[model samples]
Target: MDKIKLSKEEYENAVDEIRKFFECERDEDIGNLQGQIMMDFILEKIGPSIYNKAIDDMQKYMTEKIDDMYGYMIP
Candidate 1:
């Protein structure tokens, strides 16, 4: 996939969220710059696997729902 780019505002927002999550999950408050770095690392190392798993799950869910529809009958 092409390199994913976020606007500055969006990137800042993501960093803010990362800070909040670090605080919540680890009881540690991290600075915005640290958050940004962490987010970049995560996106590079883990994001594609997570994204692919979500897509696979969505496809499985849709396939099951479509099969259910096919099994339905008019009353």
Candidate 2:
């Protein structure tokens, strides 16, 4: 599968969230450069696993709903 690419808006949102997290969690405000570097690193390294997990969760959710629907028909 191709790597997930965040849109400009999404990337900016993520960077903003990171900036918020550092402020709330560590009481430190990180600048854009640091946030972007961190965000890029996460996108390259951790994003794939997170994306795969989301896909797996969605698949399972659909499968469960389908099975529930089938149960009503089969019974």
Measured by lDDT, the strongest candidate is 2
| Cα lDDT for residue 4, candidate 2 | 66
User: What clash pairs does model 1 have?
Assistant: none
By summed lDDT, the worst window of 10 consecutive residues in model 1 runs over 1-10
Quote model 1's TM-score.
Answer: 0.70
Candidate 2 deviant stretches above 4 angstroms: none
Q: lDDT tens string, model 2, 1-75?
A: 676688999999999999999999999999999999999999889999999999999999999999999989954
Per-candidate TM-score against the hidden true structure: 0.70, 0.84
RMSD of each: 3.0, 1.7
Give the top-scoring candidate (TM-score): 2
Model 1 alpha-carbon drift over 4 Å, by segment? 5-10, 23-29, 73-75
Q: Write the per-residue lDDT of candidate 1 for residues 2-72, one digit (tens) a residue.
A: 45667889888889999999899999989978998998987788877888899999999999999899889
